[model samples]
Target chain A: MPKTLTKKRMIINIIISLVVLLIVINICTVTGTRSISLSNVLKGPGLEPGDNIDYEIFSVRISRVLLGVFVGAALACSGAVLQAILKNPLADPYILGISSGAGLGAVIAMLLPGISLSFLGGLPIAAFAFTGAIITVSLVWSIGYFTGRSQVTSLLLAGVVINAFFSAVIMLMTLIVKTEQLRSTMYWLMGNIPEKQESFLLLSCGTFVILGIIILWRISNNLNIITLGEYESKGLGIDTEKTKIVAFSFAAFITAIAVSLSGLIGFVGLIVPHAIRLIFGPDHRQLIPLSAIYGGIFLVISDTIARTAFGQEQLPVGVITAVIGGPFFLILLARYTRKVSLMK
Target chain B: MNIIEVENLGFDYGQKTILQKVCININKGTFLGIIGPNGAGKTTLLNLLCGLLKPKTGSIQIDSKSIESYHVKELARKIAVVRQEFVPVFDFSVTEIVSMARTPYLGSFAFPTESDRQIIVESLELTDTAQFADRLLGSLSGGERQRVFIARALAQNTPILLLDEPTSFLDMKHQVGIYDLLKNAQFRQYKTIIAVTHDINLAAQYCDEILLLFPDQNYKFGSPKEVLVQEQISKVFGVEVMKGEISEKIFFIPKGNYIKNNK
Candidate 1:
């Protein structure tokens, strides 16, 4: 697309995205197991006199939608930032082995009896996932630095190696777990929106939202120059290495938080950014906000399908996202490959 | 006063020496060209001047202050560099890319002001890319992309502009265009322009001073007439010069196998 047309279309798409998000969230809230009225959903799930839709709307649907929005936004924005920093369209939060590392930590937590203390159960899971992500990124960075001049190729290769290693550990843990534990672990790995206390989701969302906003804002400058390549960015006065570290750490934090809250949701991060870039012409000032919004919308729609598709069978949301996201990703890869070949 | 002063600059990658005992001073508002063959540390010298690389055993002073004393942002405000190649990972419009030159002036969360936009537009016009301001950088041709990069550097509004092989990928027409652009930036804008190039003739045509780097562990830094001599050209490039001219200028063409023809 021409740059001007893309910018104009981006403004329109951003407006459309907001409208679509509201519509999707509303639909998800009203069309769940207990079908509620749209009016009640709009009023929110709080105390309203003479409202028949209080229970389902307030207690169950609101938190679920909120969780989907927060997780989706976190993943998508992080993915966009990661791809820009790495200078690879294929980059995502999972590419650094963060998801697999988190999975291994969660699997271990599930296996050890004493580790699942009541107050510490979910907290440990979240903490473990956060630690795993940070460790994986740091390890990849150090390995890449040690191996060569710390180019993107070395970093990506390190990620692949670490991912494979973490996956092996996760598979081993899965083999040694009990039947019930195995079922729950599998569900967690497949990714599901759990029925957490409202306070927890709120707190998680608050923390991630603040951090995500700050990161997105801070990196906008670096992202602008980074798109022009690392050498040019440095020549343009960017502290490229420091910028990369900050971007990577922020992305890892958001990804780990999303994983801790739900599980291993995929594709939201990878697809939303590409889609946003295609429309927005790769300016992070616009791309970041649009990615956040549309990522939330996309995930909410996918999760709604997961919950209501089979009428209570409750297929994992991750499976739904994969089913939808995989083909879309292939198309994206095809388009990008064509573009790269044309460049050559 | 010399805007840029390099004292005993030496650098090496591990044990492989790149630049050795290089020292030069560039006055403010002078157009200086550093010409050498491949791997002659031209780019390395530019990188050092731009603070992208720290010299191993020398010092670079900008306006009589040690370069290390200036913050990255402050250095950016003083010196801007344009590399030979800029392959962006994503598609940004010409305006967006050029606006990034204002980064050093912006706070962490600040956006570009109206005055910044005016400067960006003026830079785009200066580089003759204002017509393509809304065009995607990736969509432009190599020469057009080179101009866009020059515009980005100009938008920085720095006093010193360092270009590393700015015309490497350009055709003759665009090469002339870029040379004119650099000359204008120096004469009209009063920028201290230092360019690294392999095109000695182009350097001789436009530059106020030429620094000739030879492979024999020596360099000649002087006016184009003093540096672009037949003997120096023959010795440094290892080519016999059939004919040359220095009538208010310097121009040379290589003599291909004059000894073989005589035999």
Candidate 2:
């Protein structure tokens, strides 16, 4: 488990995983409430997809799948970077309270009347969520710096405290909403994949997320050195604070994007990186990219189950993930504790 | 020739002064050891010398250039350090861990080049850790792990090396073994080493000069024989000690109350 793969092996594995992800995406795109022919879907959708019901459904499904792909990849990569910077294996995007902050912002935006920004695909909710996430992270970082002896411990504690506070406020707001709005808000809170989105918006977010992942990839070597400890990394010529800020910001940014797109998809971040690290080794160079692909595969599969699992009633994608992730997390915790005991 | 110069250097944590008015000049290729009781700022001084901590006062010059003038990466290329042993957050392989020494030399998009790989291999061989290249660092024995760290420092290819108690948590054989490796590194590679250790005997044996720090922000610097006097040792350590010499190297045996009562 502690061994690393050779570069050749890593490349081969990535290529194989990419192929698997593509296959999963295709299967998921085809299987929905109304099953569509794989052959018809594979054929290029004409410019006027609206005229044909199948083509319209196919495009929507494909976009939803792609959204899942981007969100999943973003979360997993963010989790990997957080774990490295925080020096904690269990750290994920949600651990920093970004998800709660984004949720609170989304809830507040939904309650208010129309306030849209055309530049951000006319989604003021997303803008607010991103703002909320950033503000929460800044607050957490500041509080952590002043209160704790070590940055790692302080930030984590601050995140926990802030997360609790924000979640309570969000719940209170949810209770006050009318029954008609309550369903959508609750669904959003639980996390649902949107059936359709403006293509321009998706493209912009996809590009942003991909760029964030690439940036994290560029700093993979620095992440490797930083994991050795702050002073040790500094001695190795790293500006430890600068690296942490960069890593945390990018990780949080992408997580914020994912949270804004799809409410609060839980375990993709927490599970994918750990599984990849255990399998492929802890080298960030390989871990980051592999986690991105596998994370996509995992979420696409989960969303598909959420849509088609029961008859007619569509469950939120988050429900499927948590249903699966809860057990997976327990197993991971057990294995982690065993590993710690063995190390001791 | 002096490769490092510290003049009127001072450090403080909030209101409490840790070190003050310390001036010392270190020659190129000299093995200098810093020794003191706990809370005497040994590690702090080491941190300051490496530019990990900014000095509150005075200046440190490395190779006649101000230490602050060098960027972090530049300073790393000039000086390597091996801190006391601890488990790495991730269990990277021994070779993988050692190869990390090339961090300063790597560009943003670059992997290890041929020369970098060569240096890493040579460092592993020098520290006798080549056999464990593929093994996880966490699986190694304490002595082996220590050697792997030394190999990493060697791979850094810096002119100066600073270690903080490199032999702590080790038995006698491992202690001597690490010192022997460091001594050979000094003689063969002309590495300027400054190690902080409580083991004064090892310091006396391996270090060309010693810097003994006192809790009151005072310090004495000279050859071990000149600096490690009986009165100063007793006053600084708060213990009586019996000194012995063998092969011209001095060693101390603390005459604790338990020993006195037994006698």
Candidate 3:
């Protein structure tokens, strides 16, 4: 059973999470043939942009750590919002087909590198991916109209069908793309941190995350109302349709940004939110911010394990998270499921 | 003065018509109970009253203004509802649940003001749930949960309150306790209250007026004395209920199909 979330406990948990974040940042920076030493791990977290130090390796490591924080937070918060909007605790980018849809968009951007659209600016892939995810989420909800029941089973079915259909489209895209582009798309779809760590990418992603936090916070009260079902929310004078549209758009948009940058990383969205809910209870006011913080911590830990788990050859971070989160999901399913229906 | 006016109201679920041409005029401070058999659209009517559902055929006016003209938050400020079923997305505490009733009142990033806090406290006190305010809603008993919901509705602090079978999940003891609490709030607080109930005796004792929804978009609406006649009750329910009066309250006693069985 989950313990009650008190004010003091929430504060303590947040402080502990910050400490863990610093430790993970330390771990991410320490990379060499030699096993990580405490002192070595502490070395390159220093030196800001344009500062004097071993800027080459240290800067890349720092950038990767920042990327991990950004990607993880975006995905987890997206998951939390989706769960709230759908009124299903299990909804996430991966399960609702956002990742695959975004993956297809990113693949298209890569395949047609010469045919870049000017509107999306520097990150056309990210923009396309965002559009793809938003379209997919809306499609999934629209599909719910045909299913009659909007509760657990029908929503899951809608998500599952969209996920399956999108994956097939992505597979077809991969088959048709140029051989060189196919390899990169496969690596991305499998989930790996890309080599491009431009400061602007970091800045834009950071800005997005900050913006997401503000929007989510502003709507946090509405989220609580939404959880009690559409009638209750509508009866309370909450614009249920408006709240759902805004919240779900953010959820999918956030997931699309992460997918564009880090490939289609699964399980971070699902695993992190559920973990936070157990400790912090289900209030979106706490769940939104805490999930972002804990999401960063969870992904940094997983990414570190991915980089280090295989000697000489690094594993895609997505594989490592899946290996951990698949069983975690099964355990959750076995523990709580009266009916065995879910999206992968 | 009529706080709410429904004119020629009608609705349908899929192909089947639930209520049609139903008219009701409720004055301020009246306790109204809606009673009907299964599938008679008791909840459907409640939804239309609260603006959760738009009427298919007619119009509803609140304080002489059309229901369609009111904004969501504006309507919420004027009226509040406690529905029959709820599926909480998270296992939030009772305090959290009750505090959510302030959603329409509070602006973004606004905490409840001191006045809001006082009302919440009074609401919990009214429902006798102040002692369990900090407890998680999922951990509470059915009766306790129902009271907490009523407390939440009270915190809405609207001129009109609506509930759909508020005591459906409760035991007989708690059922009566809830109606008693509603009765006290009606006289003391002067809030216009509407509820759908299966318990005729409780409704007869508490509600000033009752609305009965029958099949095929038909309805019976009037004061308890006008609507709860023996023939009307038998016609709507399809059951023979022997009635007896105790002082001011009308009580119902069910008489099984002994004549049919004997025949």
Best candidate per DockQ, number?
Answer: 2
Put down candidate 3 lDDT per residue, B14-57, tens digits, no spaces: 78888889888999999999998889999888889998889999
Q: Categorize the docking of model 3.
A: acceptable
TM-score per model (chain B): 0.94, 0.97, 0.94
**Residue A261, model 2: Cα distance from true site in angstroms:** 0.9
Where does the lowest 10-residue lDDT sum fall in candidate 1 chain B? Answer: B254-263
What docking tier does model 2 reach? acceptable
Q: Is candidate 1 or 3 superior in lDDT?
A: 1
Q: Model 1: per-residue lDDT, tens digit, A140-253? A: 878877897757889899989999999998998889988877887888898887655456656766577657756775677677677667677776678888888788777887
Per-candidate alpha-carbon RMSD to the true structure: 3.9, 3.1, 5.4
TM-score of each: 0.89, 0.93, 0.85
lDDT of 2 by residue, A43-146 (tens): 66667745456777888899999999999999999999999999998898899899899988888887876543222443777777788888888888889879
Q: Summarize candidate 2's per-residue lDDT along B79-164 as a digit string, tens digits.
A: 99999877788868888888888889988633667788889899989998898788777888888998998999999999999999
DockQ of prediction 1: 0.37
lDDT of 1 by residue, B52-132 (tens): 889998899999999888888789999988887555778677777787888888886335677877888889899999887
In candidate 1, list every pair of residues with a backbone clash: A45-A58
Candidate 3, residues A26-126, lDDT tens digits: the string is 77767533444554444655557444345455666668878888899998888888888777776776777777677767777877856332224436767
